[model samples]
Target: MSDHPILFLPGPTEVDAELREIMARPLIGHRSAGFVDDVQQVCQRLKWLYQTSQHAVFESAPATALMEAAFRNLVRPGGRTLHLVCGAFSERWSKIATDCGRKPELLTVPWGMAHDAASLRQKLASSPTFEAVCITHNETSTGVIEPLQELAAVVRDASPSTLILADVVTSLAGAPLNFDAFGLDLAFAGTQKCLALPPGIATYALSHRALERARSIEGRGYLLDFVRAVPETEAGKTLATPCVPLLWALRAQLDRIATEGLARRFARHIAMQHETLAFMHQWQIEPFVADSAARSPTISCLKASGRDVRQLAENATKAGYKIDQGYGDLKGKTFRIGHMGDHTVARLQKMLAALLR
Candidate 1:
């Protein structure tokens, strides 16, 4: 590897050695038999990652597109949608719903605070029946991971008919998420984050309820229609030209994850978070998210009360170590360290040593 600072940002984390080789492989036509075969294998691996027995649509577009797709499919024009927001990415899905003409309401908490199940239950009780409830499993901006499983239960008990949609962009393989067991109607993720691959393709899954709801919607655009996409995806081919190179890379990366074992990988992320927290304690750097249990194992955010967060991040980048300043409204108020996607405790120690200096 070159002397370039290793990436410690939330996404595009790192490409493993095997994936590098696989991405260099000769290209294949999107509709060719060879491409279909590759995708079939990738989808199988993706289903395992998604923790769903049902097939998933691995779209060529970014994760944001899938957000709109979910809105178009589940919430018909002018239908009510509830968006639970705690950070930038979660808020974006709400915007997507708004643009799609699906009336979306935000059930929001402060940046560092995690949304609790009791609050959600109260909201569901007071609000009119909604077509869908959108949630972000891990708030990448604030480095907070919502208690998704518990929230799902709350949604089911409150409103069984409402579809539960989640964005697991940063939590997919890095955490212990069970889609089927969680009873989530729909969930999606991009390969760029914890999956440790370059940006391009995105993955999404739908439960029986979600699929039925999607079919009932009308006039969804060709590309954004989940009802139209299922047939093509079931055959391991996208609705249009797919990203062949990224698909190949995803296949290789899935093998890497499988070899490491999901449980071990999740433990590795938690252990690395613990290591970072230990360093924070020694440095007297406070965490932005006060609740220890609410913090994300994939990313750690530090308050910047006594430090120049941007300067520190810039210095690290100049010194060949990549880190991130806070995102959106929290910019300059906090700094983030991404501990997901192949970042080991030893690697983090070295990166932290460079930054702490």
Candidate 2:
């Protein structure tokens, strides 16, 4: 295991040794009583992590699967979905809606800018036919954090019938998200980023509104259908066979997170964000998201200026550290540094020092 390089880019951030050990434990039957008990316990912790009392379910697939599930289960055929697009992930949600046969309208801002709540309100007022609103709480591609609570409030007032679906794949554990209080219909996050686990499991909290919406939508697929999962969940099990190893890892990781306390965990991420940004400013390299208020504390996307960011990442990797040169269209123009999960200030400082050299 020592031969494997540590991950620092984003999603699959470094997992702690203790959690890894849990993943290597003996396999258990998915339908066994022990497994059912384990799932229930993990679901409870997930609710606490999301800061919601809503029903939380674990998906065996990655975060993208849950995103698709949200679109499929919430939006009926020929229904309309309004997607707030500012980065790659948000754009993906628009595509997902289209693929699900729903007509999707995009309210777009530039890559680095946030989709302001007022602008969303304006769009909602003009287009009241939308069945749902999809927002990426944190865009991993651009390191932008949307104002989830404010946007939710606007959507609630503008169209009470339109369900609000948020993707918090990269932001959940590292930041604060109140699913129920914010009036969100559904919110999903993968375990890899802030949960400090592997990449197989994605957890989601579903409000009663989302479930009611699903009840009205016909032809909702079986695997991801929330309507199906909710009934099986009541029996303390998944509708399908879940990844047992990932669940073990998730249980262990959630225990570790609970031990650290959510506020302190969020603070640690903020500290790393500030430390990395401060170091980048010394080199005259500004962050991709110009407004600090819109920046993500878990992931920092740094504009490369005139520097060859790809080459910088290659060099940094050779120095026993792993990093990313942004994503999609921003690949060469920006570089990203992730400080979520078990990453520490000293570790981030060392990577920054190496890059600054």
Candidate 3:
């Protein structure tokens, strides 16, 4: 209606106008007391969003930087890690571990498939004991959603000490991820997706056990180290310069999130997913993830069916809809529909209508 193409890519999703205005506010000194208060409040809201009573981490970098932080802190050098790979993003976790000098064994499932707790338990039973188990809560590349609570339960039962580090980049705030309830050691997210903010700021949560592990682990480095971040955070200070404007925007966004309530927010994402799926079904297009239980509520990766997906994407773009053209090897074979951030069911319906035309 505004003559602007609606964004339906995974992330960074469209930011609300209010958030954009907030971001445009005048910059402030990161070391000022006011900035410190802003960061502290942002961390508290992040903890509530993560549903964790542990350390709420703040990094002036993107979520990719924190991925390195998670591996460095939780897995120590040469530590064995069990990586559950289902899609492009999840697969990157293993590479990160390898690059970080950790021994990572991957239990790879085909794209569009999910790993349940029982399956993970079986995998762990046969595999060597791992210091950390890494997983992606939502696989944006394939639109597959792994059941983290169930998987964490299996880890807890099989290897109680094994740290669970979840890549929640695409799932956080879009879905309900109770970090403490799921017994996860650490989980982190970028603000661009579900948080509906611009990129460049990442929030992370680490459990008490994870902090202890980080303290004992060496070669963790300076910039992304959790050990240094925790004490500074506890003291209401930052270890380095932070993105103050983004923090301001994040605080404003968090307030809106609180007003909407996480439950309602999750329901909004679910409704959008169903609406898109219903449209996809009526159109007779195949879903990338055949299993409904494994489908991501935030991002829907649909099979291109026989249509030229590249042309379809071009058509959609010309028609004022910014949809996806898939990712990696699946590019041009699948198309994704992102339903997260500050988006609503009504907005998606309007966009779908434009694409259908």
Candidate 4:
């Protein structure tokens, strides 16, 4: 086994050695013709990975930037948006919408519970003014996985005008997200999570409708405006200079993911999640997300129960395995274990053994 300590924490999770090497490649000019070709290839691969033929842009910032971009570009001033709030990140989406001067109605559930599609349907039915709906496909804070397809269907049936914007920061690469098939207006994820790449870059896919929305709106922020990004993306470049090293790392990681194949990769994640949940059961600990259906396959949020989760995490870290101590409102009450990003079954078993010991 490698002597290096492994990362089981969500986001900035374990970076594969090959990907690390890719990032170490000498930096290239962001605007060079060769670099443009590189960026175009990366974008194409991203679209393939996202299961969408639509445009996929690589952002220099993390997923948060893309979140803000969604609001600024898609939701016009005075436009109404329905934010499905179930955890810290989901709430942040709502906050971003409001910050963009849009009136956003929040469909909230407790941190540990999944947001219900039926409730969202009712909300949309009653509120005809909503122009878009924002949802987190996987909530990292509470380890809850919202039913994206069901929720998308609900929104489509209730409000055809409502564009569906999804955050898949934690779910992408670990699970299957058919962006085109689901008809999502926009979706984005960071490279640090399931992509097993280093931080500093995010990948997002945009539908034709999303582009139209952006074109209709004026004075959207220059950096994140889809109208600006789309043309530059078609030209095989970015609006501004990008983190070239991170882009190389992303390409490497996507290549690895492709080699593994999506079906096998998703199944591997599911198996690891099940293994972690089984261990949690043995310890008499419950998952933060109570409904198994709502639990994320990439990361498992385990309730700390009577134990000090912080201390437990500290102890685990000292043993060379790092884990997450939850986030936001459930910080102390829960802990998260990431099973994504090149983490193998043997590695997970070893970590579980160390924790149980």
TM-score for every candidate vs. truth? 0.97, 0.97, 0.97, 0.97
lDDT of 4 by residue, 55-172 (tens): 8877788889988888789888888888899988999888888787888888899888887777887888777768888989998888889999889999888888889999999999
Please give the RMSD of candidate 3 to the true structure. Answer: 1.2
lDDT of each: 0.88, 0.88, 0.88, 0.87
- Candidate 3: regions farther than 4 A off: none
Model 3: per-residue lDDT, tens digit, 1-357?
555666778998888888888888888788888888887888888889999887786788899998888878778799999999998998988998899999999888988899877778888899878999999999989999899999999999999889999999999999989999999998989989999888989888899988998899988888777888876875668888878788899989999999999999999999999999999888888899989999999999999988788877887787777888999999999999888998888878878876665
Which residue pairs clash within candidate 4? Answer: none
Tens-digit lDDT string for candidate 2 (261-289): 98899999999999999999999999999
State the TM-score for model 2: 0.97
What's the C-alpha lDDT at position 177 in model 1? 92
Question: In candidate 2, which residue pairs get closer than 3 Å at backbone N, Cα or C atoms, i.e. clash?
Answer: none
Which pairs of residues collide in model 3?
Answer: none
- Scanning candidate 3 in windows of ten residues, the lowest lDDT window is 1-10
